[model samples]
Target: MSVEKPEGPGVIAEKLGAWIADVHASALPDRTVEIARLLLLDVTGLCIAGRGESYVRATLQATDPGGACTALGHAGSFSAFDAALINGTAAHGEDYDDTFEGGPVHSGAVVVPAVLAACEREGLGGEALLRGIAVGAELMCRLSLVAPRAIHSAGFHPTAVIGALAAAGGVAAALRLEARQTTSALGIAGSMAAGIIEYLAEGTSTKRMHAGWAAQSGIRAALMARGGFDGPRTVLEGKHGFFKAFAPSRAPDFSPVLETLGESWIMETIAFKPYACGTMTQPYIDCAIALAERGVQAEQIRDIVCEVGEGTVHRLWEELAVKHRPPTAYAAKFSTPFCMAVGFFDRKAGFGQFTEARIHDPAVLALAGKIRYVIDPDNEYPDNFTGHLRATLNDGTVQEVRQPHMRGGAREPLTGAELAQKFVDNAQHGGWNAALADEARGWCETVFGEPALGTIARFRQ
Candidate 1:
């Protein structure tokens, strides 16, 4: 999943700052641009989809109103930072944002909000927005590859901490910051980064806020640097650098993050989640759904043991009783036992499946109670997500099912048509009418082609 040891020493922050300063919209490959557009669409849709969610409402309520930027579902404009905060939180509120498996981080959730908010505030065009999104989202993916699971291993959330750096890079790129300025922005971002996995213990909403906080933090850092605020240019590789503080267990390998720079795109492989739950839990949900498809009724199964990667146990499998009976819908999204059980019964784990009513369903809890996990030494996670289920039937018949990898991932990505449908569905769920949803879809198709980016006012309530 990660480059095990450090590559022969290199100045990371300075090199990355140079690349961010030089990357251009016109120089980007066609396929890469297409990926960026899809990501833009996906993140916008997720933001709209997550509106009205309790966590989103809390964010909106806590944030002061009145600024120059637009939030998808809200009627009025907001400050650029507040808009970024709300949009980013809403995008990830339902855990429906895009993910990359190479190291497992959500790119769109963090980057799109910060860059788009800045563009709206500055009246920047689609090209600038696109470039910013590319820099930010791609950085999130590449950064994940630096130390991989080490971040999670150290009890920190990768998306939350690394996302600040990615957001800073994206905002700096969008604003055309100089190399030194960009380096200082990244340096400032390193200290601003903060997120812990303590939210996992309960079904709390703190994790949802991580993306937004990071996004805004990035913007603040970038703007501060642009204003001549100096910070450590060696923030990334110094003794007290970001990696040492967050992913303390491993020596970071800079290859995945620095080797290609703008040459090859790691963000192209970004995975859209088919399910609305956790990234690692997606494959297992597939396995359970497949088991149901094979005519193995829930009643016929006595107990099922899932073979899972050692890395996943703490987050998804541990607290066995809690996994079986997740405290809230939010908690269920991370509980493999509950997710698989729900997926098996419902055949899907989308927005509809994550409701308070559905999460408390008697059948789902019963099936979840029957499911358990056994750590498989050979199982791959963070690198490649796979699933395996061995069910022991009441009649002594054992049925085994395995999912080779996560669907909607680089190995088997979701089609544009599917993503479009998902976008429309998410818009509808967020309270937009069909016509409004269709308008949003049309916007996604052509927004990047526009000479100037426009507001999503049509999608606003």
Candidate 2:
């Protein structure tokens, strides 16, 4: 018996593919290019910082060492597939990579590693790299908007699932592939897309590898398409399409993805993280720090109350006791109370703040125990992440603080100086000196004009 196919092309894939094919390095806006450059720098630093992490180390151990692609800060070389996986994993291992404010999918962690690996393997140049990153990020951001929180609601990580398509679209644009092949790549990636939210249950390392898996899945899909593999054209909007499979609850609106593909750049709105924790936790960290500044000692606070978005209650505020005292440092990254306590006492939520040693500090845990949340129906999460903290001091005096928005979000972006320091700090955490970190930054700063990624080798130890 023969099987029936969808009648028309997946207009979603076709439109995305055509838009990607038409993008040129020279035609990109200065702001977009700048954002892409910073994204590259940020992800690169994050990869290096995560290289020594246990999860990343385990992933690196699973692969053999002989290929052209480079995994930042590692001496071993790997095939584009393995390298993209390894690098992508490292970039997101710490949950510190760039996040879209519209939702939580991480673009840089998934797209950069895939695009960079493809560029390096195919001998592509910096201009192609920049274009690829921009295209990939744009797609991921728009895709996140398609179903809003529905993906997470359906028990899947949006970045891990949506990232596969974004990476495919990105690499296709970077290499300037035929529009037909780009469509095939997206179709193929739909099959490769996967990652579960079960990691939230145990604080396992699975979430760290999701980005890597998606990255490698993208490379494989794109390569297969380039080699003449054909996939269903209507892979996105078919009877059993991507959204239907992953986000069954919502009816996806493709306008956010297609109508604004090029005219209004979504990548420009990408938010760089100030705190090395979950995206939702960033604003609350600001509130914690503010409370500390107001001379409200941790011990003096009877209990701290926060007005939070209901959507955040699951991954961030659930299992009340567990959220109060997360099992591991990785779990702590998602716990608003833990993040707030550490941010309050440390005055910052950098790499050092999430350490096992710091998380176990009695005072931090005690303060975290006192933190609780009340759901606010009007909270603007999955859109704007705002923070509200109302503290009842020991003397029964109430001190309240409201952080209108996340510090590193579009409204109040990180200064160049701040981003640079983050880069340097991430590099230092991975054992590179300030000088070496500066050199890598210089390369990211100017590689777009260069003929090829010749200096890329300097990143690996």
Candidate 3:
């Protein structure tokens, strides 16, 4: 008897393929292209500032010989896939990549590298790259929306998993694949999608590789589809498929995936991080900074009360002790108390503050020791990053501040100028020259006008 085939991953892939083939680069909306440019700027900044990181350096060394693609500060020559694996890892090393609320996926880390790799190999122009980025990001974000909570809570990292299919769609669109081929590529990409949240259990570099793996796997999937390979036709909806197998908690909504493809853009919902820590810790950091500014000295504070929403405490403060004293710099990025303490004392938390030296800083630790977190059952998590802080001084005076929505999120998106400044600051840390950095920024702005990506690919090297 023949085995009945599941069609979920395959069907979603097919529609995605059709979308890519039908959407012409020139037809993309002006606003979407502008959003793509912003994402590129943000990703480029992360890649630059994150280069000096040991994880980035180690990844570069492990995957050397990347051809024509830049790996931040390193000079190496490898295959296009290798370039994606290394550069993508570097971009996400600091967790400074862009985040999407509909889903927690990191778009730029996976999509940008894959598009750049395909553009380099095909000699595609900036317009195609921009369109591909937009399409890829949309697919990734929509997929995230399908079962946002279930997929995330099930211990899967959406950035590394759904992101592969998104990149595949983008590449297929850029290369002008037929609808059938595009669908097949998505099917193939589905089989390759995998990422776990186990990294949160410790500060392992495994998380860094998720984005790289997604980028490389998506590129390979697209290549296979281009070569006439057929993949499952219904990979998203069928029994034992992506939605069912990976996320069984809730039924996914497929409408968003096939919604007004060109008119409604998910890339517009992307949020760039202001802090180098986990997204969950951002609101707390803001609250701490505000409290410190109100003349609350670290020593004078008795018990620093944090009335956090249920979701933040459950996801971010699960292991309260660890959050109080993180063992490594990577672990520090996920520690709410550590991030909050640093923000309270410094008023800013950059890449430098998460270092081992800073993690062990007495002042920050002292401030952290005063923290007492109280979960507010009424406060909903994730719908929005809301936070509350109450500082009780030695004299028994309590001052409180509450933020409904974290800065730099959907409710408070960063301005173009603010994002550009972040990019420049991150690039300067990555060691890019003022002239070269300006040139890079310009290239990203008008990337659509260029005839081919040969220049940009060479720059990645």
RMSD of each: 3.9, 1.3, 2.4
- Can you give the lDDT of residue 360 in candidate 2? 86
Better of 1 and 2 by lDDT: 2
Query: Where is model 1 more than 4 Å wrong at Cα?
Result: 1-9
- In order of TM-score, best first, we have 2, 1, 3
lDDT at 109, model 2: 93
List TM-scores for all candidates, in order: 0.97, 0.98, 0.93
What does the lDDT read for residue 116 in candidate 3?
78
Whole-model lDDT per candidate: 0.89, 0.90, 0.79
- Give the TM-score (vs. native) of candidate 3: 0.93
Worst 10-residue stretch by lDDT in candidate 1? 2-11
lDDT of prediction 3: 0.79
Candidate 2, which segments miss by more than 4 Å at Cα? 1-10
Candidate 2 C-alpha error for residue 156, in Å: 0.3
Error of 2 at 431 (Å): 0.3
Which clashing pairs does model 2 show? none
* Candidate structures ordered by lDDT, highest first: 2, 1, 3
Candidate 1 per-residue C-alpha lDDT over 1-461 given as tens digits, one digit per residue, 9 for 90 to 100: 84343344376888898899999999998878888998889988898888888888888887887877888888888888999999999998889889999778999989999998888888888889989998898888988998978999999999999999999999999999999899899999999999999998998999999999999999999999999997787688778999999999999888888877778988989999999999999999999999999999999999999999999899998899998998988999999999999999989999988878977899989999999988888877779999989999999999999999999998999988889889988988888888887877788777776777665555557
